[model samples]
Structures are given as structure tokens and as C-alpha cells.
Target: MLKKQVSSAIIIVLCLFLFPTIISANTNEQLELYSEAAILIDAQSGQVLYEKNSQEKLPPASITKIATAIYAIENGNLDDIVTVSENARNAEGTKVYLEAGEQVPLLKLVQGLLINSGNDAGVAIAEHLSGSVDEFVVDFNRYLEEVIGVENTHFTNPHGLYDPDHVTTAEDMAKITQYAMKNETFREIFSTKELPWDGETWDTTLINHHVMVRDGSYEGVTGGKNGFVTEAGFTLVTTANQENISLIAVTMKTMYDNQVYEDTTKLFNYGFQHYETDTIDMNSQFVDSEDNQYKTVENIYYTKKIGEIVEEDVTTSGKLVIKGEDGRKLVEKKLELVTNKEKEKQQIKNETIYQTDDNREQHLRIIIPISLIISFLIAAFFFKQTRKI
Candidate 1:
């Protein structure tokens, strides 16, 4: 009895040490962030790993240029030369100093707009793309809503100058960054630390304003952007990749620049250290109460803490939901019920019965002739017996 008790204790200890979900659930706690709004998401799956007031509408400041840059890249001809308009030169706040009538490629304007946070470059790009900034606003907001799937974001200008109505959420900003990062041109420009700049009145190297990427402050830093306005405070977005996993972190309305960076770093660390992608194979099957089998048509990946228990629930309508231990949904996949081809084949076989009218008629004829022969033989025997008597 003593030996058996010791063995059971050892087994319990081993189980406690082996499972990651059990360890994570007991040890992990949500990190506190300094920013008013922040979110961390898996770049591949778009799953929110952590958030604090992520959907709160706040002025995005100059980070609004992220949308402007990507829009220009997708819509405007980068090689086309743009003649700087008077409106562009007179634009206020951080600028590369474009002189009136200065001829520059749209690509250079984009680089200046993103790298230097130049309000002038944004206007110029806007004018070149859509004839005027007013016209550009219409298309910009349309793209944000229709193409990018950001419902809460609104933009009034090409540069993130403070506007009362211009606002975005941390979650929405993260989504925009995730979408923008897919473009090679945007990624190259966004990740660039410094580039040679030759302007009509000014000549210098344009350096990226975001410290995490430009200064190599963080490991695996891929790209980043920063924005600041008196009304908006400090806002920052950064993307990092490690061990084949990519993440996006966005912090908005922090009191200080350091706070934004600190908050962003904390968000990234929490995601990388505690969470991982769990994949559900499409070929896996589950049976319903009625014995109908269902399967996913494509593989699904979701982010969750290591060693956390994930539950699967399938509704009769074929919605497959993956939930965390606390019953919060992590991923929802649409599944298709398996088709029972064998049952159909069996039904078809049963319907194709071999009995025909001719076969039934032949059987009836054989039975009648045999019956007549037997009767006749019986009658003959009876008659012979009577004669003997």
C-alpha cells in the first residue's frame, strides 16, 4: 500500500509538469499597459492575443499616413512624375519641404510621406491620385470601409493632422498594418531605416521615425510607424516575427513616446512568450447526435496560450466554434456535413429490384403445371385402389 501510494504521487507530479495548458492557465496573467488603447494580434490568423480598450475611438495622428501610403501604392503610378501644387507646399506640420512646381516621382513622395511623416507629401500624393484632397477623402474612406474591412476608422486628411472626426481604434490600426504589410513595396518602405532624399530646396537622408525598427531596439523587428499630435498624443504600430510566427502591436493615446514603446513591447512579449498557434486539420471529423459526420473544408489556425484547453462545439447548422477554457470564442469555422455516398448507393441498389413481369409469369406457369401433375397422379392411385376393392 505504501509503494502504491508513492507511485500515484509520482504520476501526478509528472502530469502536472508535462502539460503546457495546465501550466499556462495557472501561471499566466494579463499584462498591464500604459496606453489608453492597445492590441496585439497574430498577423497570420488575425486573432487578438491581448487587448486593452482596443476598440476605443482615438485620433490616430500621423499614423493615418499608413492608409494614405498603401492607397497610393495600390492606386497611383509610382513612376509618374507629379508637379507639386501650391496647396502641397503650404501644408502644415512635419514636411520634406517641397517647393511649388517641383517635379518628383510619386514613389519618392510616398517615401517622404511615410519616412519623414511629411504632411506636404501626403497632400501632393493625394492631389496626384485624385485631382484634389477633397476628392481623395471620399475614395480613401470608401477603401477603408469596403476594401480593408475597417468599420470604425475614418480619415479626413492624407496626413494625420488633428481633426475632430478623424479617429481609429487600436484593433482597426492593427488590421490596417496587417493588410499593408502584405505588400512588398509598402513593407520595404515601411521597414526602411534611412534613404537618400534630394528635394528642390532641401537635400538630406530621410530617417524612419519609429525607434523599434530604425534603431534595432527590439529583436526580430520587421516594420513600424509612429504618429504624434497634441490632440492625439503618441501612437505607434510595430510588427515583429520570431520562430515563424508574426505579430502586430498597436498603442494609441499614450501620454509619452516612451510609454507607447513600453506598452507595445509588453504586448509583444506577452504574445510571444505565452501564446502559440493551434491548427485544426480540415480532414478531422466529428459526428453529431444523429450520426451525421461533419468536416472542415480548410485548415484553421488560432492563437491561444500554451497548455490552455480549447473546446470544440458544433451546432446543428454546421458552425464549428473553438473556445478557450473560459468559454470565450477563439475561432469559428464553417464546416460541411460529410456526404454518405454509400447509403445513397445502397438506396439505389434497393430501388433497382430484379423482379419483372415476365419472371413472375414464368414462375406462376411452372407452379400451375406441377400442381396439375400431382393432382392427376393422386387421382390415378385412388382409382386403382377402388378397382381392387
Candidate 2:
């Protein structure tokens, strides 16, 4: 009775420990805001921390210039002099007042588009890169597909002037910005508080536009682009870092500027408050021996140390299972004796190989049937004994 009671107590304790981990792994909230779409992401892990209608397509306004700048920096010579064309000077909306035939370097034009939100700079950069604005849009769309991994985003022009068909989602914008941020030149240009061009320095007067950058909660408030139009309302993308925790917060079509900033601030705060970088040792014997069948599986060997930084509330716990191609569990691992410290150490030792289980394959040779002889002998002996009785 004592043994049974002790087993029941252990079972109850295991259930108590596992229930919260399961719940934390799936816990999330979908906030409703005036913005058409929004998303907060961990910059390092590319993990979506929070989202609100993030996939809804909407006008991206000047935010489109980010992709344009990336293309220019990658393809064009920054020192090359690009002569302003008739179309570039006549480009509608915010302009840097460049006259036709006026010569400017590729670098200045990119800075103009990013800093002053100049629509004319977008046209100039497009014309210089692809010989025409139309061609640039095609290239931009292709990059959006191939490099940015954005499905719903389309660019009609270098400047995000309102086109009925030109649209992108908050999630896509986050993804694009994340990609663009990888470029050293793009990051330098986007984050610049003051830029000098045409013998005049353009200071960013719109400091209050992105609250996270101005508020100083983050150590390196790198730089991000902001946008707004009658159709798009208000949009902003901001990147901030606190210690090793870097985050990107995007808001679109917010009813008020304060609302967007407030929402984004909340997201940044939530990430820092709940989430942390945890170093798990993946080489520990606990994780290696987690599945007793690891030794029995052919062609499968322990690989590398793997660690994941997750929310404090979310427990990093999973059961080891030998699964077939169809995802049916063939064997379950029983962790008879394992310590949390050993598990954590194993996670850090080799993280890459165990991060994904997709390549784990079952070998046919391991499934040979040889138990029939023993079963037959046991049955014959049992029958003879019964006859004697």
C-alpha cells in the first residue's frame, strides 16, 4: 500500500510539473488596436513576441523606401553621380527639391529617402539602379519574394505612394525590416539622427515619431523608419536593444501617434520583463540518455549543443519520441533518472543537431523479428506441463 501511495504521489507531482509547462508554451494574447496591423519580434531569434492583425495588408507609405535603400546600397555605387531626371524632380509628394539635371551621389539620395522621407529620392535611386522606376519595382518585388520572404507584399513604386494595389502586412514589414537591418550600410543610414547632403545637414525633426527610440529605455535604439498617409493613417517600425535582448516593434494605421507608440512600448516592455536569454547545455548526458532507445537507433548519433532563450513562464520541456514518417509515435523515452542541471548543460553542449528532428530516420534493419522462436518454445512447454497436471 505504501509503495502504491508513493507511486501515486510521484505521478501527481509529475502531472503538476508538466501542466504549467504545457500551458506556458502556448500562452499568448491578440491585442486589438486602432492600427490595422502590428507585430513585436525578438531580433535574434526572429520569434514573434506579440502581434495584432499582423498579416493584414495595408499601405506601407515611406516604409517602402527601406527596401529601396537596401537595393541601392547593394547594387549601386554610393559615390557614383546620378543626374536627376525630369521624372525624378517631378515625383509627387515629399521632395528634397532636386532640380532636373542636378547631380547627386547615390549615398546622399539614399540618406535623403530615409531621413527626410523624400519621395523624389526614391525615384532618383530607382532610375539610377534599373534605368527606370518601373524596372526597379519589378526587381524590388522579386527581392521581396526571394530575400524578404514576404508573400503578401507588393511594391508599385520606390516611394510608397498610395496605389490601390500596392500593399503589405505588418508581419511582412517586420520581416523586411529585419532583413534590411542586416545590412551594415542600411543600419547606419536608417539610424542616423542627422545627415549632411547638398552642403546642408538634414536633422531628424520627427524625433517624437517613434517613442521607443526617443524614450531611452533601450541602450542602442538603432534606427527605424516611420510612415503615414491619409489611406495608411500612421505606421512605424522601431528596433531597440536592452542588453542581449533586441526587439523590433511595428505598428500600422494607428488612430493616434501616441497609440502606436504606447502599443509598441508595451511590447518592448513585455519582452524584457518576461523573456530572457537562457544558455542550456545540450551536451549533458541527461538529454543524451533522455530516450533510452538512442543507443538502439541506427545511424543516429548525438550531435551538438543547442540552447534556446525563451520566456520565463514558458518551460522548455519535451518528450523524446521515435516517430515514423507519418508522425506516429513508435517509441516513447522514459527518463528514469535525470536532473534539471544536467538537462540544461546538455542543451548548451550541442544545440544545432537536436534543434530539429525532421532528419531523424528509422532503419528497416533495426526492426527484424526474432522473438517467434522463444514464444513457440514457451507455449510448447506450457502445453506439456498442463497435460501432465
Candidate 3:
């Protein structure tokens, strides 16, 4: 059998030579952010690397538009023409100057809503997708709660404006951003630096408002969203990638706009610098001391700090549990019991795989179950970001 150990090693080495070194913070206290709450996690694995008051509910401001944009892309036709209404045309705060009765494509509105932070465009999208903002709210929250699995977020309007009930936690926002980043359409629009907008009442270039993303000052900064209101203070969500690992950072309720940026940067640095994600090949099978066989339903991923030792164990009930060297549960996955037909399929996939030499060393990385034991090395770097005053 031919093993993929060589190829995986090559990929790791190439990444080391490509990106510059990033310094990880020594402790959570080292990250000094003005935002009241913040969180950072591995985007692909959904592993939380660092968090501060992450679950505290607070106003998300325009960050709510991230939900709005992704929802529209999934539920509405991008090419559909939408008739703008008076409410949308008259939306306050930032806007694309949508005119009453003016026709616009749903895709264009989403672009304007995200790239330019157009409040009017968000209203237009809500009206077009669900008839009215009131109706949009009911379905919108359901999509977020049911589809995205965001528990602590409740968006009252398509455009995140000041509302006491329109709130989300930093953790929930990070999860939402993580889910949105998976969609190619959402990712393309989220990372867009600039776009040309031809509106009924206004014509201009829609520039991304995320300072670091638009200015290209931060490395690996792929996508971002900025939000603020008198009530919400300032909020932000940012995504970045380093090597094979991607990170999602969220900061909420900073006194200044720059502080939110600062908090997000700190989270990114901590995540990218300290953690790395490892994959569990779907073709790999596992066995326990009792000789029960199991396999993952699909490719699974988990993130861990550099040089941290972890353990992998398969239960009799077909569950995979990953723990730290100290026995703390880090990640849990449900495995599938090996059956006659399933073994044949897995055998076909693993035909070319052969175990290495007797002296081969295996490091317990994240949660991949490629062999009888899931073992691999993990390492990375992170930096703290401060919002510029």
C-alpha cells in the first residue's frame, strides 16, 4: 500500500518557507483590546483559540449585514430585479441612495450592502426577499438559528441599526462568519475590496470599510465586516488565512472604531500564531482496545496549539474523542461502525496505503483518523492587532 505521509510532509514544509514568522502572545492578558468582548477560532475546524467575554450578548451594529448578505445569496436569485420601496429609499445612516420604485438586481444590492455598508441596499434586499422588513426578520432569524446554528444572535433588521433586541455575541458572530466563508459567492463578496455600483440615485465605487482589509496593511487578511451605532458602539468580524489554517475573529462594543480593529487583530494574531489545523482523512479507519472498528463519515478537522501533545481514543459506541495530554476533552466526533459493505469501500480507498518503518514517529496532532491511531505534528504563529486610533 502507498501512504500519503510523504505528500503531507511536503505540504507542511512548503508552507514554512512561504509565510513570514508571526509572534504568538504569551498569555490572554497580553492581548489588550478595548472592545468589551472578542473571540477567535479556527475557521475550518471551528476550534476556539482565544476568547474574552465571547458569549456576552451585545449589539452587533452593521455586522448584522453579514447574516443578511449570506442569507440573500442562499435564498434569493442574484439576477432577480427588486423594486425599491420608500422605506428602503429613506433608510438612515450609510446608504447607496436607493430610489423609490427603482429597479435593481439582488446581487448588486448585496454588493452595495456589504462593500459600501449601504443601509438602503440592505433594506431593499429585505423587502425584495421577504416582502417587508418585519417578515424578513422572522425568516432571517430562523435561517441564522436553524441553518447557521447561531444561538445567541437575534437580528431585528436586515441592516444592523441600533436596536436593543438586535444583539449577538462575539462567539456567535465568529460562527456566522465561519459558515458564510464556506460559500464561494459569500466569500467572494466578503473579501471584495472595491466594486463599481450603478445606482438609481447614486453612482460610485463601493469600497470596503474594513480599514485593514481595504488598506492591505494586515497579512492574510481575506475578508472583513465593520459595524457601529450609538448603541452598539463598534463591532467587527474578520477572516484571515495562514498556511492551511483559516481564522475567524470577532470584536464587539469598542469605544472607538480603531479599537475594534485592534481587538480583531489581536485575536487573529493569537489564532494564526498559536494554532494549526489537522485533517482526518475519510478513508482512514480506527480501532479500540476492544477491537471495535469505526470510520469517519467525512473529512474531519481539529486545531491545536504548536507543540501541544494530545490523544485520540475511539469508543465502543462509535464516537471519537480527542483530548489534551492532560486528559481534557478538546474535540469529539461521532464515528461510523465498520460494516461489510463499508469495509469494502474503505478498503478500496486505502488499497495503496502502507505503514511506515518500525522506527517511524507519530505525533498526536488534532483529530484526523488516518490510521489505527490519528497522529501528526502541529505548529503555527499568531500576532496581536491593535485598532489604530
Best by lDDT: 1
Q: Please, what are the lDDT tens digits per residue for candidate 1 over residues 302-385?
A: 877666789888776677888887777989888887955557677777665544655778899999999999999999999999
**lDDT tens per residue, model 2, 1-389:** 99999999999999999996765553344455567688887665466768888888899888888878887887889999999898998999887777888888899888888887889889999999898988988988998898778899998999898998889988988888888888899988878776545522333343333445445655567877778778887788888877656778888887676777677767777666555432223332334423321122222111111223222111224344443223433333332234455566678766756544323433323333335666788999999999999
Number of the candidate with higher TM-score, 2 or 3:
3
Which residue segments of model 3 deviate by more than 4 Å? 1-30, 339-389
Question: For candidate 2, which ten residues in a row score worst on lDDT?
Answer: 296-305
Q: Which ten residues in a row have the lowest lDDT in candidate 1?
A: 20-29
**Regions more than 4 Å wrong, model 1:** 1-22, 25-28, 279-299, 307-316, 325-327, 335-389
Stretches of candidate 2 above 4 Å error? 1-32, 199-220, 278-389
Better of 1 and 2 by TM-score: 1
Looking at model 1, residue 113 earns an lDDT score of 93
Query: Of the candidates numbered 2 and 3, which has the greater lDDT value?
Result: 3
| Clashes in predicted model 1 | 3
